[model samples]
Target: MWIVFDLCVEGADGCEGLAIDSTLDHPDAMWVYSQGNWTHSTFATGDPFVYVQLQEYGNVVEEIDSDSLVVRFGFVKNMPTVINSDLEISFGLPENDVVSLKIYDIQGRVIRQILKNKTLNAGYHSFSWSLFDASGEHVPSGIYFIELKALRSGQREVKKLLVVR
Candidate 1:
């Protein structure tokens, strides 16, 4: 799974100061810091595209099988109505794309961003949520929604979740 993150590099002619500062070699933090320059006709023609290839750099810690589920809008909707603790969400991706999974309140406010701008393989994938808000505090018992969206593929899925004490 490779994701292409681009910087327009558009600015003044003397933009030699523009550079991509990468501190960590990890795939998740491939490009930590980046400086932009001018990429238009004034500075240059055609923006330079960077296709970053995602690589696995650790031992297999844990794995779960989720082959039975199907991809609906780049995700599945199978979830528990009421839960005592964590929630498991299962979904499938047809192809490699930038995926983001977020928990939203009933009023359509983002509660927690579980996954953001992560490169996921094309297959069944699962994520466990601790039902906590952005501040790491446990959410109140109520209704929430899981929004699975693929930015590149333009796919989105919204499913409801009920948390109870």
Candidate 2:
């Protein structure tokens, strides 16, 4: 993610000698610090603009066998009701392998295996979760973690998700 903070000031002489300083107030804002330095531009009418740019970096991978696979997961319904929330995960594999997708609580206990040892080809695939446990019981509303693992490739990926009751 890239954040560009623009500070613009207008004056009779185009904002000459104007200085803008910024402080990050949010945890996500910390990503903007990696941009190193910011440049300021001034106009003849005493107007000035300061820009701060930052870059974000991260990798999400799902192991479906012995290879590393890229994956994406999210909640299908942003605002889900107690009986209709769903979670979705999509991933690509390199070859035919057995893949497993599991949901776990924050305590690291596996709640259920949404996808078991299923053989998949080297292509894109997706699965949707109905927010139910292994016994067909609905889990309480809260934050949960999804773990994707490929047994053949020895690769693994994990992502956080939210479930609303």
Candidate 3:
């Protein structure tokens, strides 16, 4: 699913407001508009920022002074439902490179290293976890974050997973 929000500020008249819009495609796709443009910020599993272009039509001579404008886009992935005890998260890269997948607790402590500096192929890949700590002990039911870092592209992706008894 895709969602977007737009906030417009008129420098000419000192007007400011917000506009919201969203769209969804059948099966598994979505599109959202922000600041009079479509955003692709949440396209697919590991896609980057969405491209957008803005155009304004007005006479420059009418303005008394310089004005400023700003735009922002954000999105999230709806992870599939999985048993907390059998929770396993995985993603693939576009090229063969070193990737790291780490699990961190709410206290910002490194609980386990699911994947560590492993060279992977360019395509879809995944990893599974049994929700256990480094010492082969089951952790308490709570929230956790899985961090994916790619060295080649210098990209970092984070996904949240839940564990319940």
Candidate 4:
């Protein structure tokens, strides 16, 4: 599990804090930031001020390609969202853990398994859903729920998703 120590300054318009690497065996040796739709690799020689592009849905769609970092923790900014054709879900992880994102009906029946026991890095992440079910069929418009679960950490967060299609 990831722990966050708040370090916010008044009138600054944003909060900042030091996030130690919790997932790596050697926290000082390696750091991993996961983001965007594509994957690339980069190695840094020293402390680099990473430029992260924040998408319309939320913060930082592109990751910092580096070996170590002082990251931000416990900042989850999932969109106050509704789904028509797609939905963008964003979350923050404290460490490297197996996570699952699932959609369920109002009656608590599983609709879709977006991420099933998938391992992910500790950082903010964004994922888009096409509003399709597990069998590749479009679901009817109704009230649904989105479940984000960290398997190893035993942390779960549920949000309401309204599909208007």
* Top-lDDT structure, candidate number: 1
Scanning candidate 4 in windows of ten residues, the lowest lDDT window is 30-39
23-128 in candidate 1: lDDT tens per residue? 2333232232133322322222233333322232223444666655455454565477788798888888877789999999988899899999999888878989
Candidate 3: segments with Cα more than 4 A from true spot: 1-78
Tens digit per residue, CA lDDT, model 4, 22-137: 22333344333333222233443444343332222243445776546544433267565576887778888878889899999999999899889999998778887888898999
- Candidate 3 lDDT by residue in tens digits, 87-124: 64646565666888888887888899987888776555
Per-residue lDDT value at 78 in model 3: 48
Give the alpha-carbon lDDT of every model. Answer: 0.67, 0.59, 0.59, 0.67
> Local error of candidate 4 at 21, Å?
38
Look at candidate 4 and tell me the lDDT of residue 94. 76
- Model 2 misplacement above 4 A: 1-84
TM-score of each: 0.54, 0.48, 0.50, 0.54
TM-score, cand. 3: 0.50
Order the candidate numbers by lDDT, best to worst: 1, 4, 3, 2
Model 2 C-alpha lDDT versus the unseen true structure: 0.59
